[model samples]
Target: MTTVIFIHGTGVRGREYEETFKTIEKKIYAERPDVKIERCLWGDKLGTSLLASGASIPRYDETLALDEEEEEDKEILRWKQLYCDPLYELRLLLLKPGEERSDNPFAESPLDELRSRVDNFTPSDKLQAKLAEAGITEVFGEAREAVIRSNAYNEAWDNVSAESLGEYSNVISRAIAAQAMLICYQQEKYAPVLTNAKLRDQLVELLSLDLAEAELGLGDWALEQIARLALPIGTNYVVGKRGAVTNKISPMPCDILLYQARGGKIRDFIRETIAEAEPPVVLLAHSLGGIACVDLLVEQSLPKVAHLVTVGSQVPFLYEINALCSLEFGQPLPEHFPEWLNIYDLRDFLSYKGSQIFPKVRDELVNSKQPFPRSHSAYWEQDKTWEYIMEILPR
Candidate 1:
């Protein structure tokens, strides 16, 4: 059995994190009971807490509070301690090179002297008795554990949210499946070996072929739909009745449009993720994720990607440019590609019939025959897609 590593995409954190992980795990194991799975959590603990409180957690915050303070006076005090304190700056200094449990600057602060007073500051019995005239009462409880989790935290931490739950789930599953597939790709498990560079070229060529074949074979209704999605080639169109001719055909601009619609900040994210990760990895992009992958691949920024698989993606035809994908969020795709597969469904209206950019590796191109389900998400539930992906996975 192959081991699959799951990576969550934006707006997922806190208690919702536990539920999301559990749901994905259950789905995978239910399909292949013997498969071993693990997770790579990129989330921060403190960010989770601030989000739970409905406060914006900046990247600099590192601790999450379990209990909330709501009293007007207490809330102001909590804000000073939590947000404006020298404590946070001190923490940063402590985290600097070669310092984890060393002495803190707080020891030199006036707060340190105030803390010292606690040793000798208990009230005397006579004083307590005198104060009893006012009839003041105080209540205190021992500390107990409390859990804080929310999608807001996830958005704060993961930079994703609940509204696009379906899309995010699909993107995460593709990454997980790619990790599983990388196992086979490394081992050359399938009859035709597919490497990242080879697969990318092959897929681009296949997209060209498939688009050609689809255009040739489509019924009148299908052709009309394709025409609607395509930018008119070799023609001049008036821009906004200014009556000027433009050389290029512009499709509806789905990738950038979806990126904004999904509330995702796509630009720095993919490039930053690629810059940060270590080598020898697989990239699984779902829908807009495919656009991200194209950005990384085209730039040759992610040279270590062993394989890439895009599922239910509209990315293959996203560009009018021949090189990299021309989405607004990232730079164009490479003329050469990584080992990749564009998985799609005929019934799913969200995906293109065939992407236009993927080029062939050798004469041989790997296209698995499977029916991707109705929803953009149903690919995860299909045994054929999962099994085919596993067969190509690198060990």
Candidate 2:
């Protein structure tokens, strides 16, 4: 006899989380009725709270922010992305065919100038102070490496003419810097900075200060604003339905921060749930819950916890960035770690691959045919998700 424990992600609670849990249970029962199914619902008990009752959310009820504040906040979230992936934007650069090789073999390479400038460039004092205050540990060197190795950087290098090399200095350095102070504001530490709209821009502006001052403005920021002029209805949420949108997304980042800062309670909740369930166990977790389960399994061996299934999860990405609570970068998974199956959809940017990093693990693909944000939550609705789980359930 086997048991499958359902662990839900952040920002999910009460009725909706319960209904999805039921859906999963119903699917499992249809396939393997004898197998036990239980849930690990930790949001209500341990989720982050808005003690100020969302006093922090600016213009909470307003149809619009009545200012550039909303736009600036969106920009801040862009950099918070750099904290997770330094090359997040660099990778989006449109690749142009590199300059046709100069007929002269000895023409000095434009890339040489970039390397020299990168080596000589000094990080500003303000940037250093800000980095320290921002809880940005161990990023610049990695960011530099990531930028240098990026396809966009290489493409830019190849595309530059010796005459244009000077123009490209700030572009390349800023690329190395990525979004200039581009740490995504997803962290609780950045909460105060985000509240003050100027700070995020100051942070981004300070990022550019340390780079080339001649300022050719060589960088291409892919904000990629889709002009849906015809979709007047799309603006309704911002015009009059701010609360509906605000309330739904507000908890996501805060919950991630809460788990990172103090996730012991959440993990302990999982242990408590496990203690009540029969062995052997299948830890079926989604999103942040999968991350929690991975952390738990890596920290210690629970023999009864036999298999792990993570859907639309960031476990691999977190580990890669050394942000995971239990494992350090390059550290091997614990000898007692259970078999893992990571399920993902191509459209879900939040999801990542595990098989490449851990050869023994399996990765399952499901197409929700939905765009991101939506794709993230669509995993539970797919039949393939359950079919894959049934194949591995210990009979």
Candidate 3:
């Protein structure tokens, strides 16, 4: 019997997360009654709680009351204590300066350390140049500027009645955080780096500082905002909470795959799931989950995934970051690589055609008639998604 293993992507947790898969399971069972299906729940295992609910907001009077000696150190110390060290290693990995191309054409330079990180896997000279240009300073500058210019926060506060201060603030905080992520992700150049946790933290840190300067507190509300923004990038939760906050933060679907690809806490879970499953196993992974499955096949040397399918995944873009654990540049597909099919919609910015990049894989482009993330997410709800999976399953 074939066991179809469904691995979910980021921003999913609790009963709601399970229900999403259960809906798919029902669909799968109806078509292939003999097939067994199970979901890999890795969110709680690898998830970190970065935000708290009840951090004290510094009053404007308090800011005014601070001694000159305390003022200079306060901002610096708050950022350093909260964010600097946590992002240090990641900054090192991503921000190393690139060397100029030499006249000799063969001489390596100091930047090779950065280049070697994804030597063969580098996407293109143009893309490499773009990656080389990436720096935390530029990221911070851009985010800070955007936050200062945006009227979204002010409007949110203005709309709040005195009686609804608490609830409105929470909503506004989430909106601002979401807006920050959206602004960052919408940038074509920066979108690829959004998966890099250190960079994401840097953006949030700078944005938080801007918010604080604009009178938002560095309290539980801000922490939660940063945490929520960091979710998509697969960063470990760095903020701590004091009072109870509503569990509105969901796991980013990409986090599970990104973290697992990096040898995260879910490694054993993946191994055990594959080992215990019945033979002729098929992997039906969505979004980043597909990338995780590919990583398993390449990095872990598991050759038993007979059939593999991906829906609305960013695997092609991941190839640009040198993050895809498998399929290095110019390398032939592994002899044991599973039969692969990738499905995506044109409207989904995150989804891309993978067959051209990974020649062995088949690509299916369907029109979702939705915009952006909705297109990325709408795959499961469509009948065509099921048809494609059923078409590939062993008869």
* Cα TM-score per model: 0.34, 0.56, 0.49
Q: Give the per-residue lDDT digits (tens) of candidate 1, residues 35-109.
A: 555443333321112224423322331322333223223212311232222122122222223313333555543
lDDT of each: 0.36, 0.67, 0.52
Best lDDT goes to which candidate?
A: 2
Model 1 clash count equals 42
- Candidate 3 lDDT for residue 195: 29
Regions of candidate 3 where Cα sits further than 4 Å from its true position: 51-250, 253-262
Worst 10 residues of 2 by lDDT: 224-233
Candidate 2, pairs of clashing residues: 79-182, 79-183, 79-184, 80-183, 80-184, 81-184
Give per-residue CA lDDT, model 2, range 1-395, as digits (tens): 89999999988876657767766787788878899988788998788767887676664333432222233233344443443454544444344335555534675454564555565655678877765543343455655665666676665555555554444554454455442234433222222232222333444455554553444544333333211110122354564655555665767888999999999989999988998999999999989999999988888789999899999989888888888889898998988999999999886778999987776679999976544455687676566787899888999
lDDT of 3: 0.52
Model 3 agreement with the true structure over 1-395: per-residue lDDT tens digits: 88888876666555544755766787898889999987777666765343453244222211112212222223223232222123222222122233233334476432332223222221334433433333222343344344334454333333323333333333332333333344543442233223233333333443333222222332333333333232221112312221221133334633643474554455567767888888788888877677777777766666557888888787777776665656566665677788998988766667877887887788887764443344565566556778888999885
Stretches of candidate 1 above 4 Å error? 1-267, 274-279, 320-336, 353-356, 360-374
Per-model C-alpha RMSD: 27.5, 19.3, 21.6
Q: How should the candidates be ordered by TM-score, best one leading?
A: 2, 3, 1
